[model samples]
Target: MNLGPLEIGLIILAVLLLFGYKKLPDASRSLGRSMRIFKGEMKGMKDDDVRGKEEATTVRGQLAPPAAASPTAGAPDYEAEALAAEARAAEARAAEARARADAARSGVTPADGTR
Candidate 1:
């Protein structure tokens, strides 16, 4: 199904009627920008896929190397990491609470509700 000149004209007319001439330039500019961004993202995805394929081929003969191989990597000690992260988060929450309390006592609103 080919859109001849008449079909194209009708579509253009419909668009003009839907969005007046005054708004056409802004709409067209936005459309063009969106298309360019979409094209760039698609190109990036294609490049990533190609690189992944190349890497897979290169590693086909040998075992893939470990992502991290520190002395502590032997044992999967995720529990320690989780605990450390939790402790940090708890400290942050405590500090925020203290800031809010101080702000309330001083009769001033905290900068971000937690200062």
Candidate 2:
């Protein structure tokens, strides 16, 4: 709840009577000074928070990310692998043909059926 004008006036009157007019000015001045100091401290903290956030963002920006590319970009193609496999198959067939020729020259006939 908030104090209405009546309550506030009563409080002021009480203070005035307790600490007469002579001391009231000094008391109010000190209170104002303290409030200003407190306000300044709060402002400083807010500025520090802003500065910290700015610095963090700058640091994050400095750390560059890897470049983006398509999934098939800068990658080996399977077509090349298929061609290499075909070449290997051809080499295997040639070797098998040479083996058969050597066996025929040595008289190893198919009718032998030797294990």
Which has the greatest lDDT? 1
Put down candidate 2 lDDT per residue, 11-30, tens digits, no spaces: 99998899999998777765
Query: Each model's TM-score?
Result: 0.46, 0.44
- Candidate 1 lDDT tens digits, 1-115: 9999999999999999999999998787657655654565567558656755555434545543455745455764444544565566557656755665566457587686422
TM-score computed on alpha carbons, candidate 2? 0.44
Task: In angstroms, give how far residue 5 of model 2 lies from its true place.
Answer: 6.9
Per-structure clash totals for the candidates:
0, 0
Candidate 2 displacement at residue 12 in angstroms: 2.9
Residue 112 CA displacement from its true place in model 1, Å: 31
Per-residue lDDT of 23 in model 2:
100
Please identify model 2 stretches exceeding 4 Å from their true place. 1-9, 60-115
